[model samples]
Target: MASKESDAVRRHWATNRKAAEENRQDGDQELADHRWAELTTEPADVDYLAVPGRRAQWIVPHGAAADRALLCLHGGGFVGGSQYSHRKLFAHLARAVGVRALVFDYPLAPDHPHPAQVDDAVDTYRWLLDQGIAPEHILFTGDSAGGGLTITTQLRARSVGLPLPAGAMPFSPWVDFEATGASYDENRDRDAFFHRDLVRGLAWIFLGPDGSPRDPFVNPLYGDLTGLGPIYIQVGGDEVLLDDAQQLAAGAEKAGVEVELDVFPEMQHTFQMAAGRAPEADDAIRRMGRFARRVLELETR
Candidate 1:
């Protein structure tokens, strides 16, 4: 049985879903983005700074560890989300994990596609390295398409001989560009914000004319899973992307990588967006924080 708060969240998102559908029909991406951004609670105590060489914001939570960092990617289906929209959520996660988080914007699709997003992610990771943050002290995380980039960026980093981060946390990652996951249909009616058509449309825009859906950089589920560090994935049981998390966990485990996947029942996609307002979201962030602490070996204060 779902908690009362969870049920309330479901109702709220159902309303949001209707609005999103109407917004889409009206060709209002900006309004849809604004509506989604309204779900997050901004942190009043966190310091926001601009990265010198990248289009990124550094969200430094009070009392956070200066030596540890989280490279956070915001999810907007590779088209809409930005650092401002996700900065609060990233700040909450970073505060919980006792680290600063860098949330950056990359070129979105239909204008700049596939390789551009990956390139920006790789460049940001390199910038963090150059800032003297050790690879082992850093973690990567994001939601939706940004979640997928958490993995792809690691792959990109490895291709260029950059050291891998200590761990990753991908919340409701949109990893299957082919949309072959059974959850797409199984949870179709259960999920509020996503439908097959919307996902397909986003994929087309993000992949452009030259990109392949199966390219590991485009979809990390198809990438080689060997040699990556620990990964913790969280997905809503009601989300259409549930199978993406399941498959990625299975594939990573098969390749001898440490992986943990949590499926929250009766939750919507990226429910972590409701952080600070929902118990489930808070629990999920705490779990990720615990995982980050274990991987980074940060002693409890």
Candidate 2:
């Protein structure tokens, strides 16, 4: 039931899988950006910015709320992805929510692994607080591996005594480092890329020699989920990670946290990357905006 534009996501992953299998993958840069570049119409209403001392870039939509921020940790299997690759995607979200967005970057795997990405995300978040953006006014958001980080980073920050943000919005999140989610098996043939082999390999690289894939800190599937902010999750129903979102929502709910999980049937992974070019993607963004606005206590117009 996906629209014609959905083909962009399919083609994007197909090309990535082809290159990866051939061992000719160009560090995953082109293929990763291709999803956003090919599917997203540039959001013309936002101004992109870089603070000299920060590890992130800002996508400030015109008339954005001065005190609110959406901190985006983009997805690239923890190996590759950056603000440059994700700016427009985040910009679209920022514009929808009427707030500024920070597209954060961290060192990639095999070069910087494990706690490194978590540390970077925490540091950027604290820096946002230091810059006068209130913790209650912020939301953590991202896709794929970044979506997983949106959860893990909050756990790390809480361990170090930082106040939790207003909420988190994670879509197509890759949270089950063990890849134990049944959706992986169910959607294996449905998903052209991200087979168990590829995902498990990424998990090992992300964990590094000192980390453990099953450790709650790294995987979060076994971690305590208490005291976190409300969570809103979106996942392509066709994704191998579908159960990741389901299990995470169930875990958060069991922990007494608020959870809203929206599954887009027959959609490809990170299909929200198709925002502005696809109705399904736009609908997803609208839901995120509503959740963020309500959680942040912004007056809904």
Candidate 3:
């Protein structure tokens, strides 16, 4: 049986689904920002710092390895999300992995559009590299749309001859811009948010008037996966995006890129947001930390 705390994610979405939709309709991001931050319990022994020359912040857990970094892309459907909203969540993961995290805000869609997010992501990555962090010591990670960026950023960076990170971890990634996944239908009743209509609307805004939903950088499921680092994906079993995780893993493996997929039964989208307050979320972070350590070639024993 799942722990009672597991239902917290489910309740969070179900309770806020209406308000979030209303916020979108009302053109307000403040509520969504506050709501997103409220999901995670503040982790102890983690310090936050502003990143110079960027709309980014560092989540430095006490005694974390100075040489390793977790580059996080905040997720809000490419339309919302920020460093402040995701700091606690990143802090929990950084603490678990024994490394520091850097989370940043990319321009939102319906205003900035495609390639803007990817450009910012690639730039942030390049900035990390410039900061003297070795590619082998950094891991690209994100949740939701940012999860999609975990793969797309590498594609964008590679096009410009940038070195790939050691690995990537995408939490409840929304990779299928086309929203053609069968899980959308299968998990419709189970998912409180993430209906196809909602995703289509967001994609339309994100892709803009000329953007192609099938474009490699916009929808990474259709992107080339060869030569990229290993991918670790985690999604809820009840999420409408379950197939997104499965499809991404398959694509990675087919291209000879290492992949690991974990579907947490009965959990909601991005359930890891409940870190520090839920056993399920804590377990997921631990698994992700282990994977990060192994791929980064850090001592795991």
Per-candidate TM vs. native? 0.93, 0.96, 0.96
Give the per-residue lDDT of model 1 (tens digit) for 109-142. Answer: 8789889999999998999999999999999999
Q: Candidate 2 at 119: error in angstroms?
A: 0.6
lDDT per residue as tens, model 3, 1-301: 5678878778878876786677745355876777788879999999999977888898899998989999998888988888888889999999988998999989998889998999999999999999899998999999999999999999999999999899899999988988999999999999988899889999999999999999999888678889988889999999999999999999999999999999999888999998988899999999999999888877754
* List of clashing residue pairs for candidate 2: none
Error of 1 at 116 (Å): 0.8
lDDT, candidate 3, at 176: 90
Question: What is the overall TM-score of model 1 with all chains considered together?
Answer: 0.93
Candidate 1 or 3, higher lDDT? 3
Regions of model 1 farther than 4 Å from truth: 4-33
lDDT of 1: 0.87
True lDDT of residue 23, candidate 2? 94
User: Model 2 misses residue 290 by how many Å?
Assistant: 0.8
Reference-based lDDT, residue 185, model 3:
97
